[model samples]
Target: MWIVLMAESYDRLKKRAQNRRSDAEEAAKYIFDIPEDMLSDLSDDDDDNDPDFLSPEDLDDVDANTEPSDDYSVETPPSSHQQQPEPTASTGKSKKKLKVQEKFGWRKVEIKKVDLSWKGEPRQVPGILETPLKYFQKFFDDELLELIVEQSNLFALQTEGCNLCLTVEELKVFMSIILLLGVIKVPYYRMHWEAATRYPKISDKMGRQRFAKIKRFLHFNDNSKAKKSGEQGFDKLYKIRPVLGHIRSKFLEVTPEENHSIDEQMILSRGEAA
Candidate 1:
């Protein structure tokens, strides 16, 4: 009799468990917006099978993965430009996401202006009212011009085995032509000497061939001793580094304006652009 009663109690417990599982599964199907494929995965004919049973954790995971409904209230935080939906009391997953966003989202509230005082005295150039050439000579002195002439002749001798005979006066005339070329746009350098588009100021100053030769061999620094790429002390502006250093030193001689702007353009003849 005792064994029969134990069997009856076990059957009753099994029936109650099956009924509870059926109600929970039915609620999950309606409450959660799960796909038909997922619903198939969750379904099982045998309620006693442990592996096929869906736990509370499985339901939470499925709920988290499902998309939110369209009935939630829209909210805008005081600091955020974007509008977000306010999670209803039932949406614990949305509340967690909102918390995460609130933790990380930050922005600048206000900015203050800062005033800087100049410590150096104002600079004055004596006789700056003189000719523009005199003021220009302050930067491009005779020593710099002589160095150019030396480099040009040396480069020509080393590479082409010919005498450039590039004198300081000839170099000055060459410089004038270069400045004038900037003002008068021409597609080709030889175009300036063409009869149809000839300028006496440019054509009569120097022969076309001489100008071409000087331009081809002009050097500010010795290329023979320049450091190669990937080597220590290699300079990107190896050709004009000496001239740049000289100009930098000259710039230090005069004080700069408290408020001024400098715009620069570099044109490369041959090799990579810096």
Candidate 2:
């Protein structure tokens, strides 16, 4: 009796499961049907006569890939812009497309020059030295000039190879040769300098090597011992700082007349170089 009861219960469960599956499948399946009123304007008397038009019964098999009805119509309001299609679309296609145009507008900005005139009285510097010769003396006095010579000798000694090896007297002769070179048009051939020049009274000439040595090691001041101003980008000529300072002082000391003049000219066939 118990076995029979179990069999009956199993059958009831199977029947219940089948009913639930049917309910779920019915929920998933849907259909959208257009109301006759909405498609009223799409109706045509000639639709029945159209060769490719299908009846409502045939529409139920639309999922089977039925061809679209040639007489299918949508209600589009008449627009004047719609043009008559050309013969190309008589083979059945949309021949025309509409295009929209875009426009751009730009606004320009103004630019003005920056002002650079002085705002107030310029800061003044205190005067120190007087004459240009005195300024030159301040940097190249007897003791400093002697030191310059000695330093040059030390450098010549340390010079690589045997170049410019010279005694003190030879160095003096070299300095003399360089001094005459400023006023003489003699090219730096050793024989040209040592040769008898136009001025026979002038005495003593040296070889070019000594002169070249002096030129190489010559400096207005000892570069290693030079001082620096605290300002950034401050570049006074390192070799000629003393002379520059003196020249600057000479200008600062001058009390120019209210009426000033400026002149620029060439001397001895040289303009900018001169």
Most accurate candidate by TM-score: 1
State which candidate has the highest lDDT.
1
Which segments of model 2 are wrong by more than 4 Å? 1-144, 150-176, 189-191, 194-205, 222-236, 246-274
Question: What tens-digit string does per-residue lDDT give for candidate 2 at 1-274?
Answer: 9788667866765676677643322222211234545445444545777889986668877857776677987778745466544333333465544443433457796878888565555545548647865654554445545555665655555554334444455545555555565676555444354555433322336445545666787644555564578756555676666556655665776554434487765346644564
lDDT score at residue 131, model 1, on the 0-100 scale: 92
Q: Output the TM-score of candidate 2.
A: 0.30
Taking all chains together, each candidate's TM-score versus the true structure is 0.55, 0.30
* Cα lDDT of model 1 by residue, 37-86, tens digit: 66755555555477767867888998999887798967756655555666
List clashing residue pairs in candidate 1.
none
Q: How many pairs collide in each candidate, listed in order?
A: 0, 0
The 10 consecutive residues of candidate 2 with the worst lDDT sum are: 23-32
